[model samples]
Target chain A: MTSWIAGVDVGGGGIRVQVRTDDVGLKARDRGPVPRIAGAIDTSRLCGRIGELINSVVESGARPAFERIAVGLTGMPGLVRPAELADQLRLHVKTSSVVVASDSVTTHLGALGGEAGCVVSAGTGAIALGTDHRSTWNRADGWGYLLGDEGGGGWIGTQGIRAALRFHDRRDGGSEALLRKVEHQFGGVSAALAAIYNSPSPIHSAATLAPLVADAAHEDDPVARAIWVEAGRLLAESAFAAARGLPQTYSWGGRLFDAGELLLGPFRDEVLKRSPDAEIRPPQGQAADGALLLAARGIPAGAIAEPYVHEFA
Target chain B: MTSWIAGVDVGGGGIRVQVRTDDVGLKARDRGPVPRIAGAIDTSRLCGRIGELINSVVESGARPAFERIAVGLTGMPGLVRPAELADQLRLHVKTSSVVVASDSVTTHLGALGGEAGCVVSAGTGAIALGTDHRSTWNRADGWGYLLGDEGGGGWIGTQGIRAALRFHDRRDGGSEALLRKVEHQFGGVSAALAAIYNSPSPIHSAATLAPLVADAAHEDDPVARAIWVEAGRLLAESAFAAARGLPQTYSWGGRLFDAGELLLGPFRDEVLKRSPDAEIRPPQGQAADGALLLAARGIPAGAIAEPYVHEFA
Candidate 1:
């Protein structure tokens, strides 16, 4: 018997939630800001918010009770302890079982359904996850803004800002088109720096400029195109590393959705260079969709995935 | 005959000042943290402090009246406005002539003895400066810690910390020896993160660990050695760009002194590859000495080098 389930993508500013039921299929519910970062998560605050969200969904008669739930914390294993978080969240939501995992896991599950494949999620940060037919998963990179996050939206945006400043100063590696675009977007270099410094999330603030870079790429600006080319290569290389030569199919996911062949062209070339037979496909749905699959027991969570979201009590 | 003059390396934490006389050669007067970055400089406060320093030196019989003074502001040309700063300071100091320049220019001057050559100063940030025989100067990198500054102490330290974290997690590209060294250095990963997040100058805090990386390299840790190799190459490439293929000499300065050949070997090789006759030599004096040269009119501050430190009184 099919029953109700929910999937949540808890982010720094807010949480995006999706509810799925046998009769209703899948629908988005209310979204509210959670604490932030898988690592900086305030468990009590998050659990309380989860409880409120579940109550609102049920009180409004979205469903009588959720049979299962899945949560993809932005930083799962490294930042948030899946088992502990699952237990805390269970007390608030009515669920017989819950699956908790990294947002990367949800991305993979959502993009590939129950099929074996790799999903490379590139937003403010970038990470790659792959699973075999047996649902065993391997993950790579997402080292945040400093150490790594190569080729992600934030990386691109940062490069755009830096290049713009250099170009404005008539410094080397400066591009006129890029400088104009970044100046227009940021209202000037100092403003851009100010915004980044004053903002609560510098990474996300920078990521917002990725589109300007993407636009620059469209114009065939060599500087802009270079960033994308490097990004695509890095992303593909990282995703391939996670997949370990198994399940030759891959999906690209994240805010930099379908940057067209600009990103995909290099990504595809990089992947095919190694695997030759590798296929790059677009994800069918978002991470929430994958979370639903985990909730419905259509796929099992790996060791890092934390299959059980419900509290024992 | 040289008159009493002062040269100051206005640093982030404190001011390193040298009171120079025709007879004394070079004498360090006092040092106290002034400000961190160029943007953070408080003109009034700095000028007041400078006034006090001059008074202290005179009162202690170090000097009678300063005939000339040169101040090498850490981020003068880029982050700090040279003319405006010089004008503000002149109102407070007793000097007929004063010169102001980026610390990089002074670093080059001090290292090259007012001759045409390149100086790579890699401390909290990295920058290279070079001048042709005609005194036309060019600068490379030093784009601050965020944009660039590769091969600087801050960069090496940051790399060391990142490698340590990755190794601790047994993540991809981790080195066991590096991890052990990092853990011992920071007391643990959590402590390291705390130090970075809680510090006023995260960049400086990270830079503090560069010594640890050097130690690791001393023990032949692959990860630590790789960072130095990369750093050496980057510093050389940047210095080459600034030199414009003219000067065949280079002076490497900063806290990375203890790193020895682990850094200099690759740096020398890279520089020599570009300029086969290039000579790498130890710096004859510090930036303060360069400032003294500026004060004595021993070297003309290029158009790029603002040659006035006097405030419009």
Candidate 2:
């Protein structure tokens, strides 16, 4: 009865936390933004803050003897060192054991409720992680914006801007209407150009256009529609690449995926076309819930995807 | 006797100056590197240096009342302002008919010998310009490295690095050979990643791989060969787009084109496939000679291409 377990999902928009024990099913809370992968956030400061937040959520002593704590954060080990994060977390959080990982790892666990499957997390960036029943896992894309990020918002937005520029240059004369949509999205073409050309962190700025692209697509702009179509194909391609000869329970998760059918319709079509056995179902819970399952020792050792796990203890 | 008509073709590698009159044409001088477009180059200082070099070649007193001077400088009006060059030139020489223009326009003038044709200036960058018999002009794809530069060295090298990284990820099952080539080129896989991901001016750094990619292509690496093939197709597409409805005198002129048949064979096939009438011909003269034509009023007004012209006087 004294055992306590918790999970943390740290993302760009904000951080979400969940705590649970066998007697108590689950308790959850939502907070403001966390340090992004590599942008303006400091990992040490953020980790210490996360430790404080965990205490608040559990409503326990200053140093709760938690049985286990699992954290899924963006920028783990890629843009930021995983060891730095683990060392900082150990300094701040008092727990018998604490572990951190990529948000995609906890995503698959929470979304599938521990049943083996694949998940395509499409947000500012996109990554796909899949594990077969045998517990072997593989991942595709999500190499950040520089390398890849195929179907993510940043990718889609960049593609849209490229199309709009081509239309301005009269490459695709049919893209004039899309150009107007883009001009309107950024106040004007000049402003958009300035933002795109002059910005330091162009990925974040480009992602600001995702909503405009979605609306234009819904409005039947051929260029915009083409953007979503290619996005669907690329995202699915990433998923198929990661599925690695296994049946996949595919769940598309991300803020942009919130476009629902506007985005998922094409994504689903593309995913099913390649993997006829893929189950294009909705996610059962958010990433935080998956973290909760990890905290409570719900995920089996064999089923734990090692490719994504930065830490096991 | 004091009148001199001269053209200057300023590019990344070096500067070429051609001095001539109706009775005599002096051979052009190839000097050291000039200011490159969009790199760490100071325009005013470079312009003064160009002026000094021009005077030396003409064998005339400083501030000689030259009949006409036309300059084709890289980055002018794109990375550097045309006024900056003109103003700086005025400091070193006295010429009422001095005109500063983009290297691309001067390239087309020089390569075609003032004929109506498309010139694909392929180097660290790529730009295509075309003029019809009616004097109407069109340009395609020279938006620098960020937005475009599809067939340029930067594009080819970037694509190669991407392929190499994919091989590093073990994504391309058949890319082992290409990976070794990339490792050898960049001193190792780790250095390659650091150069690609950490360099401030990654375009220039990535372009350094162009030669390595060319060698790998010749060695029969499928991935490397694919890079060249795609480069050829994209460069040709840019030419075709610029040619518009007119019959184009297509000339591919740049340092990377120095790969001779290794680069041009595939490019020729692609260009000829789309443009059967495209006369695959070598440049009649170098860019400095083309600028000399501009200075001497050799370019006919009827077939003049002004889209790339930075100055008219």
Candidate 3:
């Protein structure tokens, strides 16, 4: 009997799963995130959903138990007990071992393909992690929207909206192009402001407007372009800061990089500017692929132990 | 019987009423703000509360109808219709005429003593209004905490906390003093951050930490002091911007100015730096006092007509 391995990427948007056995592989996604109860990961529900996703991805045959499973979760650190989550998974899926890690770790592995390097992942927020997966674990930013996440989507969107409002108010540094876009999207700046304030997740609200900024930047809007340029620089700074004791090899993962040269141009410029010998590479895969790699191959040599990467046998 | 006048200041903190008749004046306060329903002021509840406070401020006797009553409301501009509010006020208080003005207008009246100058009011938020009361109405930087309100208490507190978080993250520009204070106040920076994010009024939560920044600045913490300096400079810029085409005479209102030299020093420096002949005067009274002045003396000479200041007889 061929053994199967499963990988799960749990994020704010939803849950994605990958299954592999022999040379065949399959992927599936659930449009709902693991329900969090009062700041905690609902382990039972998460395991149940992970089981459903894994089953859906596997070919229709006699239901086969997975040999191992790995999960990269958004709110993993300090929010979930790995041992308990592993135990819960045992009840839902037939797996001999379970691995749990922060999405940052998975992102790092996915970006650098388990090689020692720095990876800055920016989506709704931004965080950089540098590790040899053995002893070093340097982190930068990811402080959320209020305090940090500086060069992330939330930051870029906020700057864009603020510039729009500046134009609306006829203040200096206002951008007419951005203002027109914002007015079209939110009816007016005041209404947009009100919507942001009243939003349950204000960070996401701000981040949702990031594409508008990118679009404006692409159109040669000076203020919007400046915002992206600054964002790239700030993200590079975070990468370098995280890369302190690590090698000068850097990469990035996350949808923010989807803007292509708009972000990469400045990000690459700053990284090389900071360290002339630095190497910048495109990501190998994604968080789910990294998680699947962990499940299929087990922990790589020099990978950090418990707390960062936990295993239950 | 000599006619009496009433002035009510409705703010986020609460409502305060001042009643004047003959040579005596009485004051009373209600610690609860006017109830808001679906983003609109509950005029009925507000009028009921205003009536109770007004009656409380008058000596126990036969209630004499007021000749005029002026209200300075925090959310008057768009949240409440002045005529509707006036009709509501008439039902609660036997007044022949009612005056309703934005807190900005009243703050201007109080700070400049009805003069044609500029006043910047900084509290939980900040705003600047410059009007001749007859024609000019140049306003600047009241865009709330999200977009504007730079240099306001909320802005100061946010910058302070951000520095603290940077320290916690071991990032550049971090302040040890601020980190220590934040940890002391909120047990930990992460906890403090969670609280702020979970707060219904995140701006107020940030503003509440302004005193900590102020204290740290007083202790000569460079980061905290720099924040205040920038804040003062920003406020001054707003003041000067509003003062455009008007007299360079300027004054300030709101408890934020109570920081005294810490704020006033940089504020005055920036104001003078922007305009050599600018005059910085101490505020003559509070917002309520301006509302009272409006009620007693009616609109000042050359004071701009309706919308800015409304009178229903």
TM agreement with the true structure for every prediction: 0.80, 0.82, 0.91
Question: What is the docking quality class of candidate 1?
Answer: acceptable
lDDT at A202, model 2: 72
Interface RMSD of 3: 1.9
DockQ of 1: 0.24
Please tell me the TM-score of chain B in candidate 3 relative to the true structure's chain B: 0.95
DockQ, every prediction: 0.24, 0.28, 0.46
The fnat score for candidate 2 comes to 0.09
* Residue range B16-88, candidate 3, lDDT tens digits: 8889988888898888956988768988889889999998777678688899999988764667889988999
What TM value does model 1 have?
Answer: 0.80
- What tens digits encode model 1's per-residue C-alpha lDDT throughout B135-201? 4666677766666676888889888877775555444566677777766767876666667755776
Q: What are the candidates' interface root-mean-square deviations?
A: 4.1, 2.7, 1.9
Q: Given candidate 3, what's the lDDT at residue B302?
A: 62
| Runs of candidate 3 exceeding 4 Å displacement | A32-49, A78-92, A297-313, B33-45, B76-91, B297-313
State model 2's lDDT.
0.73
Higher-lDDT candidate among 1 and 3?
3
